[model samples]
Target chain A: MADKLLITSSPHIRAAKTVRSIMLDVVIALVPASVAAVVFFGVKAFGVLAASTISAVLAEYLYEKAVKRPVTVGDLSAVVTGLLLGLTLPPAVPLYVPVVGSAFAIVVAKQVFGGLGTNFVNPALAGRAFVLAAWPLHVTSAWLNPLTMDAATGATPLHAFKGGQAAGSLVDLLIGNRLGSLGETSAIAILLGGAYLLMRGVIDYRIPVAYLGTLGLGVFIFGKPGALFQGDPLRGILLGGAMLGAFFMATDYVTSPVTPKGRTYMGIGAGLITLLIRYWGDYPEGVTYAILLMNLATPLIDKFVVPRYYGYAHDVAARRKANRAGGELS
Target chain B: MQFISILLAGVLTSNFIFMQYLGLCAFVGLSEQFETAIGMSGAVIFVMTFASTVAAAFEQFILVPFGLEYLRTIAYILVIAAFVQLVEIFLKKTAPSLYKALGIYLPLITTNCAVLGAAMLNVKNQYGILWGTVNGLAGALGWSLAIVIFAGIRERWKFMNIPEVLKGFPLALISTGLMSLGFLGFSGLFKTILK
Candidate 1:
């Protein structure tokens, strides 16, 4: 009888979720945007997605094998990173762009700093940043027109919008009729995926809510060139990668803050930076950099915004004083 | 309005460490701990501000009048070294704990390119003493912001299982590169606004 009961360490009762399961859910959540990309941008978008996803997995497997570490490709985090990177890129980039970007994302951004959760910044965004820097012309201007899939040389809606011209109708923006990154064009699709993630409890609500809310508020306040409180907030949130980033990238479990309050601050900070970049900086889309900047700040936020131990809520000051005293002593 | 633009440019667009890649020796050396980074930041803010003021004064009263532009670099270094010495003495007397914390890096500020760079930039921009001081304060604030944030990130590296090859400076450089990538968002921020 005693032999029938397995002896184990603490945490004998395990949660049903695993890293693979969580990653699988994220993959599912991304499907709407992926489908939207293919529908809007044609077969090339599919190729970009496949190239990045496969290359990311392959890079992780090869790097792990080379370094004699346990292979973690089965966890599917690489797939998510690759897919996210592909989604953020211009739809018509050469295949090598996704390949190189994914390889860099997996090996340098994710694996080198210790794989997955240990990476300081979001791996996909880091890859996008690298590719953007390496091939600025291709990454920034390779936009495809919806349905026709013709190369678009005109300014994206974001650029026109920044120039105080009307971007498009609200419905067109929602259905992704504008020229932009592959998956970021379709606001509705991204929202669907974000809703799924929120409902499944896979991501915290504070980040997306705070992010979009602050962005909306900011756009309203200072969006128009010669007017205040007259800018179109609805158009602001729907345009560019704000929808996609607020939902997917900014909520990455690894690079985001763990505490709820810290996550909210992260969201607000990202929003403010995005506004700053979009309004005044060279970039038309600020979502990627804004999220990456906030990721850098996550550690600072976590360090300062620690949650109080349960039942010791009122002892916060005393605990802080004690900790400071202990620090001085050390 | 010009002051605001200069401040924004100094703090974000042309950050001393991330953008210009100046004063990296102290940036990497003193960023291991958060408390120490804060101490260094305060020291830099003091030394850089005073150094810029004095350098601008020298440039205005001595270099330009004497047509001694050739000696500008040496004169700026002298001004910086003098200011660093002043900071060392002041911190030692007023804040011994911070003085001990800053220790070698305090004196090393004499060699920090950001300080000299700020002074030189003031001369190049032909900023008056007041504007140069503001620029100095902005640059130092930007450097302090980078180190403090970096120290926060590095503090967590203690628990991470970083790969053997990429430990220490290699990893630090990689992290700094990625951070610089993030800071790229701030590039051209002043193009539209300040125009």
Candidate 2:
């Protein structure tokens, strides 16, 4: 009898999941936020998104063709990069900026680093940080208010926070009815996007919730209460890029730690760094820098946070050595 | 003389990579391997120099004149992205071997805030087109210098016995912190020179 034989050393049933499919899911998840950006920023948003996507794809495609590598640009990771890059920029950015950001996102950060998975950091954030550092006036200069381009342009929430006013009403912030980066204003919209991601299992909640909760706790604990208790920690949580960073940036698969314990620590670190920067550092918004800093910590976190085998002695050799040394000293 | 100052300021004192800690993703990420390190640096040098020149012109002649100065970030991003693509293509066709090594790392340059930051600084500092190009080159050189130094340190790092936790990036960060502390010495140079 020809019996059905089990043939597997490990992973008896390999999940039918590919990077290509995951990226597509992410694309689907981002659609709501993309639509919101377009609605808020107008046709300019669409143009920026298109330019960024096309340029990222084209850059990766041509880079692959030149190198004679199998083109992975079809995976739509370039599109993801383009979208993330677009969301990071101010909506009023010129038509060309997204396209350029797209190229940088794909070619230099992604392609040069041995393509998508091998990249050490989030390509989108890396690109954003690079341009923001290189062209401060450009990144900081052009911001579009929701649905209003001509009347009142450059009043990002952080700018207002720096100016010492009640930075924003909770409602305005929640609804994305305030001035900020292209896609970062609305706590509600970002939370919606985040929820979609969670539902899709594209990411886990540990990183985001931990990062956000810690930020809220740290801010409230460190900051003075207004008239009520703890100075409205929710405000600290809602304002800035807390939502964006928690949901999007901190969850970056490439740059974040692998082990659960490491992820927890990373979230804690992200929170502390973010609070430190937002409260005292020069920048009013600290999510980008905080996330980048934590990304730098992921490899180390993984190294130390390795899982232990069940029922095995914890550092048995070390314990033996210590006992021997103790006996010798006596 | 003013142009020289712009160049100097962009390169030494107000550098995008090391001093200001901008575009650190590439600096920290690519510093591990020398080949990609050099390639990334080359891309930065070319893009920075060219982008600065074009951005200066665009800001002065186009955006400022057209009253679309608000679009600087978007405009610069687009221009820089397109330019990087062009350079990638040219490098591929002219230098396939170099292209092969640098291929995967190119797309990440798009979101690099340092490139955009420099372009914006050019306008903020009221630099002319000529001055912008110089600043760009200087900034690029500064970036390359930082990466080269970092690469050297990281190369040595491969041999040294390091704690498991601090082996890869943690140690790298500690080293970067030390290097940054060292850069503090040069800050005085700018102060005296400018003064």
Candidate 3:
């Protein structure tokens, strides 16, 4: 006999990758956008970023310590969430805003459920949502002009566009030369980070593709003020937080649907809701709430949209045939 | 249109669970199973309707008559506690299965803030008995809709690969927040309609 076979459970094939490494890749991918934000908004952006990331990590460490759970700061998910939250804020937010938001993200959003992988929604987004509700004026009215770093008080590009006014030029919009959320203004930087994630195999492609495609289609059909098929689809796709959310937030593995079909539906549903809010609702931007809504639906999507197990089709067919024969006899 | 507006505001726009954040204990704790949620909701609807009617009648007839307007809280609690006792005893004798399924939750409804909130809100809104009862029924319906939908979602959440920390109540709270975001869409619906 072949020398005693070494049998173990499945998963014989394994990679050297770990959660720490994957989270590191995400952090690395986010760097370009953070850099872009710093470049555009100057030192204020850096302050917000540091405050958020530090408070997020601190919140996680402190919570775990107090609760006697093992500290998870080493994994760096909180850091990523903090960085993402920082990036979403207006560059000129009061420093305490990021701190409060980070605490909310880690303590309330992440650690309260279980700690890390158990969180059902994106912590940063939940934090943002909370503070947004708590202080709507600060969240909505704190936009700053890029490069100039002046407190520019005006509606964002999406808002202006919604009101039938033209926004920035395509180049300006693409290159972080617009007034919007800190990380969301630079389409080029977001694309760079998104592309890196896609190439690194850190994220599934179905979600971003389905999300952007549906959003583009939706805007093309219904984005214009009065006419169908006359809307600026490129503008719709390139604007405010769509790129950031589709690539970064919606792709958070813990909160997203696992199956390919389910992920696709998640993306499309988010995109549809985003366009619905952007077009017909009061909000000028809808990406945050859209992704949050889809995150809520992820479990439902996974439950219903499971991929067929290898032998399930045959089993189903056999059962159906047996039932048909029984019916004929009856 | 006015009645429809009231119905919409109660059921969707100013939803008791999502917007007003009423009855959250039952919404969060008992919303784990769809059947359990339905049972809890049915019991709430029964309790809230009757409680609001009785509370309204008491406030309108007795409390406000003398100088005991400040006794609303005490009187309301007594009324709710008595009504819940009647429900518990009646269910235990007539519908033992439901009584068992409800278990402690039947009596727990006595402390449910939504019941008290509905009664107080009816008083605050100063509606007559008919509208007071309608508001009570509608508020309960809204709570039922929210908890039942959340229960269905939580059932699916069981099979998901949730992280450790966000597994239970924290995750439930976050999910509630997201559902509230969805309901936030209805904020201006009645504003535009009734304008």
Model 2 TM = 0.59
Per-residue lDDT for A1-330 in model 3, tens only? 111211232221121125667789899999989999999999999999999999999999898889876566776788999999998898888889999999998987767666776566788888887777777788887888899999998788888776667987999989989988889999999999989999999889999999999999998887777788887888888887899999999998877877677889989998988886677556667788888878767655655565655566745554445334322221
Q: Please state the error at residue A257 of candidate 3 in Å.
A: 1.8
Compute the DockQ of candidate 1.
0.81
* Number of the predicted model whose DockQ against the real structure is largest: 1
Most lDDT-accurate candidate: 1
Report the C-alpha displacement of residue A86, candidate 3, in angstroms.
Answer: 1.0
lDDT of 3 at A198: 93
lDDT of 1 by residue, B1-195 (tens): 888888888888999989988889889998998888998898888788888998989888999999999988888887778777877888889988977877667777887889999998887888889999999999999999899989988987887788787888999998899899999989998676574
- Candidate 1 per-residue lDDT, tens place, A1-330, comes to 322232243232121135667788899999999999999999999999999999999999999999988677877899999999999999999999999999999988879888876788999999999999899999999999999999988898888877779999999999998898988999989989988898888888999999999999999998888999988899899988999999999998878887777889999999999998999788777898999999999878877776566556645664465334323221
- DockQ of model 3, rounded to 2 decimals: 0.20
Give model 2's DockQ, 2 decimals.
0.03
Better of 1 and 2 by DockQ: 1
Worst 10 residues of 3 chain B by lDDT: B186-195
Model 2 / residue A314 / CA error / Å: 5.0
